[model samples]
Each structure stands twice: as C-alpha cells, then as structure tokens.
Target: MSQRKRSIITASLLATTLLAASPALLAGNHSSHHGDNQHDMTEMCDNMREGKGHFNKADRQEKMAEQREAMANRLKLSDEQREIWSEMHEEKRQQHEKRMGKWQKKMDERCAQSQK
Candidate 1:
C-alpha cells in the first residue's frame, strides 16, 4: 500500500509538471501559420482542464481514505486515535482551503492588475 501510494504521488507530480510545461510548448509554436492548429490547441486545453478537474476529485477522495487507513495502521491506533486523526485532518483541510483561497485571490488580483 505504501508503494502504491508513493507511485500515485509520483505520477501526480509528473502529470502536474507536464501540464505546467505545456504552455511553453504551445508558446513555442506561435510562429505556425496554420489556423486549425490554434483551434486544436484551444480544444486540447479545454479537454485537459475538464479531465484534470474530474481526476482531482476522484484522486482526492481516494487519497483521503487511504491516508486515514495508513495512519490508523501505522499508529496501531484505537478509536481515540481515529477521533484525533479526524480532528487533525479537518484542521489541516481547513488550513489548506484558506491558504488556497488566499493564493487564488492574490493571483486574481495580479491578473487584474496586469490587465489594467
């Protein structure tokens, strides 16, 4: 299970890196004279975004369950451990959401400022 988890994490990281690198690839092709290529790029971006959203939803659910199980097993945990884990998990989750929200707001402001 640990190996599987590591593999999933590695794969997710690789996918994220590849996705981030894609804009460079697209940008490199800007000298292309083909109009259809632009349309294809737009379609690819839309499809990739939709696919990523679905993948993230499913991946997050699976990771949460796996994390709980792994923590329980590694800790030789009891019911009390489970309760404590839940509290810790919720706290971490809320913190992450808050951080992400702030990050998103900052990014939006930067984008808006750049546009202006």
Candidate 2:
C-alpha cells in the first residue's frame, strides 16, 4: 500500500475505535449523573418528610392548583369536559396519595431497619 492509503486506513480505524468506545464512555458519564440525581432526590424526599424543604401542605396544594389551572387552559376544555377533567384529576390525586402512602411506609421500614 502507498503511504497516503496507509495513513487514511489508520485514521479510519482510529475513528471507528473512538466511535465504538464513545457510547461506553458516555454511558459511564450518564450513570454518574443518574447517581447524583438519585442522591439529590433522596435528599429532597428526606427534607420533605422532615418538613425542612418547601414541601408543606399549603405549598403542595398551591402547586396542584397551578397544575390544574395550567392543564385546563392548555386543553381549553368545555364545561362538560372541565367537569370530567376535574373528576379524573381527583381520581388521580387519590391514587397518587395512596401510592405515596405505601412508598412512605416502605421508606420508614427501610430507615428503621438501617437504624438497627
């Protein structure tokens, strides 16, 4: 092979190798970010449970109201549709509360076990 051809081939191989390794490198970076996110989420949850964060009942209620208003405006719902939306929203709220209750129980158990 000529010198130019050999250089081109070497460059192509290097590029291919780097491309193949890039995803693994990127995935490692993503995993580190995921870990950080998990830590942040856990800390936030702890603060909320301890009533140390902006996680009070009034704040939560206000946020929920804002969300509902945003959704209503975005959907431009009719009166009937608004009623249906309200019903669905209430159902979802109940379901979410139930799920959160279970999660809180699990977290409490986990914390209790860790303390022992």
TM-score of each: 0.44, 0.60
lDDT string for model 1 (74-114, tens) is 98888897889889888998898798778657755654554
For model 2, residues 1-116, the per-residue Cα lDDT tens digits are 99999999999999999999998887654667877876676776677568665657667877888999898989999999999998998899899889988987887776555446
Q: What TM-score would candidate 1 get against the native?
A: 0.44
What lDDT score goes with residue 61 in model 1? 67
Per-candidate local distance difference test: 0.73, 0.81
Quick one: best lDDT, which candidate? 2
Q: What lDDT does model 1 reach?
A: 0.73
List clashing residue pairs in candidate 2. none
Per-residue lDDT value at 57 in model 1: 52
